[model samples]
Target: MKTTCKSLLLYVLIASVAVNAFDPFTATFVVGVGAALGRWIYEYSQEKCDSKWIAFNATGLETDLERRLFGQHIASRIILKAVTGFMKNDNPKKPLVLSLHGWTGTGKNFVSQMIAENIYKEGMESSFVHVFTSELHFPHPSQLETYKTQLQQWVKGNVTNCAQSMFIFDEMDKMHPGLIDSIKPYLDYYDKLDGVSYRKAIFIFLSNAGGESITQTALDFWSAGRDREEIELRDLEVALSLSVFNNKKSGLWHTSLIDKNLVDFFVPFLPLEHKHVVLCALAEMEAKGLQRNLDVADRVARDLVYFPKPERVFSVKGCKTIDSKLDYYT
Candidate 1:
């Protein structure tokens, strides 16, 4: 009885001290910390439960991809089909892979930006849309192993978080050997692993490997007085694929993505002519909220150098330098 009374007295004393020590300031601090912690927990739960899959506006995207993306009808069509198919597919065995071969300034990067904008909720800034540049990301040949490990981890981590992801690889022709092959596992036909499925993802490769042949083909058509549109997918697909495969300098060379036919599409970006540059300039002007000025566009187009020496057939840099050249005209 005496020991029990002493224990009760000790409990009462501790309770009194706690109450006294908790002043108004202490109470407010405690409440503030608790509220902050609660908010943090709630936000974390929301993020975890949130669905990263963004709903694509098919009709709107198709129109924008076609309209905003100038001069590449074949590429636009293939991109549309791939995006639509992947989004609608309930079961996919492998990821949609595309090899975009063209010279610089043919809108390869622009098309990629368009895809991200339409497909991803956050657009190019989305965590799901990852862009890897050979020159920027992995330039050294010795870094191939490191790059492979990093690439695999990145793919696995993102797919685990969200199945719908887009990966754009730029300067593929400058990439180190075996680096491009690192993604074969994620791209190949496979079942889900650890609840992660990469089949819903998209992979785009941009390269200038076959720029010479593409330019030659375009020039040949111009010389023959044939319409540029006369050069179709059939005329370039096989040749471009072969050129990328055969060239040792190409990133796709010796990579099974091309040899094993894992690449879903080989979309060639044709060289932009004077007319396309003018269109680009006009588009730029419009984007700046300025009225359509054909005179300014013509002047911009004239300022750019053209090829075939004497004939001065086409815009040498395509629409690559049009944006900067427009500043002077404006």
Candidate 2:
């Protein structure tokens, strides 16, 4: 509006200088052009601002994240609740930060993808969704300083540009502790932070750091003749946090995030049972548009390796390889 008004005034001045008096017709034409330009500018600015509001599909996310993630009832439920609250909170003071801890192939990554797919119209391909794997992006220990700088800048730049941005850091167990701490600022609560508010952003960290402790807790419950369903978030919360903080291999060890309690949730993906594996196999078959067969699913489940020779408790790889293992039955 300012630019257009200035240009219009300049045009009238030039016209008046050229012809002792400004032509009313020329002045009217310039004013009309300025009005059009001002409207265009207003529209452009609105579009830019509206681009930050993501089309979050809460209902679809509930179905996909819950259905796809098996053998993790407690974790899935907590995730759904946290996400629902996060989305509904109009003016959040901190980013929604989640630390997913569990065994490999136990649906940590799968759940993350489900969240991304449902929240983003472009699914996993959305530019607003950023994924970083330690193996792929932070492979060198010597580059920890550089990685920290880049990570902070990347997050600040994205969140500043789009408050609804989402970031996923995979294989977080391999990321440096220093690097992990770099994200603490964004997760901390402040009325106004760094001249930019990150209250609407989302950050997810995936790792196997607490898998052993989680599995053991589950196993203890099973041995005590308790139903697997009895295991709850309250049961694992303290253990999971301690494991992540005390384990030397975990990137979060001794981090201020734990002390400040910045992590919104510690969701643990429990080990998958045979029934969960069967469900996974069935889902995979359905994805291929193949008819479901209980016999095939049963065989695939039996063939999967389980731990503790006698008990034969949990699937070694959970449902991680269930899709590929289904081919053997064919």
Candidate 3:
């Protein structure tokens, strides 16, 4: 009844203006256009939390991670299980918090991108997927207090808007220590803070904080003549977390997030070997819609610097410069 009366009043108002503003045909056209514009604005501004916008394809994520992401089998597996399990749950106790630690170009950012692409229809372009770079977003140390307040509000407001929202913090190694603690409340086991449940949200922290420890473990395996793929999460998680906590340079220096067991996983992205770099080059070519050129890919991979003096087992920067390097080679 209320809806019908509203429609009648709206129609009457339009009819009232039909004479002075426009002819009958013109008035109808104007009203139609106005309605369409209003609807378009609403659709454009609001992102729906329906299946159309948010759907997790676990198989797709696993397959892509296996195909597109090279090396670091442990990181890939942990990501798949942790994310898949969390999304599958109807009611989670706390937000899924993952701290991805690795050296540059070893696929920390790449893995994060893959996760977003699988969950959100718009991928990295989705409004619900928020990315904050420590250096770019919160550079000034003197503003630690201000950054904390703003950071808390940002997470709270975004999660309120969409519970399944993904927040990625890039370059966490450079982030001020206490700044992250501001949002610690959101990562806790609480059902809700201020009547808003953050349990469904996702928080990812990327950093080079524990790269040394991870690399050392991989190097040790190589020294023992074991396959790099044989390296497991059990081999690295403990040392990695400890190193990240102790390292003064790492943004997570003695953070309560780790102390209180808030971070669910300290995923270690191992250094990329020569073969992995070659795979990266080939994948880049495929992504660019180019024909698979093994020779070009080989050259591109070989051109990069590798480590450990004579052995040169791992690519120093992994696939970090693969895209531009491919452009130069091809």
Candidate 4:
């Protein structure tokens, strides 16, 4: 009877040990599943956050410009927010510099990633200078009218009682001629025309408009009814005799038909000193191998730093234009 009882006790102990041994395997399986699920959730959350940030920050950038210029930079959205803050503020007057990129480039290319990165590092809410770019495609006549109306509404809504704003229109040559007329209302009112002190806005129109048709138009403006041959000859002479920074060379005089009643056209040529600074900046960028093309290097450099010494003179013998400067830098 005693022996039988002891055997039974041993059997029960063995069964208990076997049950305990399986607990570790069960626990390990549960832990593995939990870890995997946690990792997947964290990754998904991060991706969602990044997408939201990008969309929130790039509110006003033209889609094409954003895709082409800021596609690589991670901090573009941040820089844009800083710029928007500056635009909204009314205190401590600062010029609103608008950069218009030429054909085949986005504003981001002209502004450069380095510059945008630097702007982001400065932190948001700090009052930095403001710069904007109208990199959207040239609008049709109807589109231009629509844009004008929308812009007017925006100003009325956001900039109440504001006295002045600076405006820059880049690639003016690419825009429909009628669009130019649509903007006249803004310019005229800002300049305090008709004895009213509305706003003080300085308008800058930058374009490559010295082509045959443009030149002929200038000739026609001066003297109508001339043969195409005579107009072409006069246009050629006018184009050649005009100073490098002259309106004729820069194609700013085309605004006469659009806004003749407004202030006399003011097309300040970028100074030679500024040109040299641009060249030096490009050279520095090239030394760093940021870009291979001289034009690209110069543009990137300008985006990084404005002409530090606007008064420092540089010769124009070989660096006659921005294009020439780009060639030398390259």
The TM-score leader among the candidates is 3
**Model 4 poorest 10 in a row by lDDT:** 121-130
Candidates, ranked, TM-score:
3, 1, 2, 4
Predicted structure with the largest lDDT when compared to the true one: 3
Q: TM-scores, in order shown? A: 0.83, 0.82, 0.89, 0.33
Q: What is the C-alpha lDDT profile of model 1 across 167-210, one tens digit per residue? A: 89999888886787887878888887666778888899999888
Displacement of the residue 192 alpha carbon in candidate 4, Å? 6.3
Candidate 3 off by > 4 Å: 1-46
Candidates in descending lDDT order: 3, 2, 1, 4
* C-alpha lDDT of candidate 2 relative to the true structure: 0.83
lDDT (Cα atoms) of all candidates against the true structure: 0.79, 0.83, 0.89, 0.38
| Candidate 4 per-residue C-alpha lDDT over 80-142 given as tens digits, one digit per residue, 9 for 90 to 100 | 444455434544233333222122211222443333333332222112212223347444445
Which candidate, 3 or 4, would have the higher TM-score against the true structure? 3
Q: Can you list the residue pairs that collide in candidate 3?
A: none
Which clashing pairs does model 4 show? 294-330
> To one decimal, what is the Cα RMSD in angstroms of model 1 from the true structure?
10.9
Could you give candidate 2's per-residue lDDT for residues 25-121 as a string of tens digits?
Answer: 8767766665676676656434242434366778988898667778888888988888888988889878899999999989998888888776765
* Deviation (Å) of 206 in candidate 3: 0.4
Model 2 TM-score, 2 decimals: 0.82
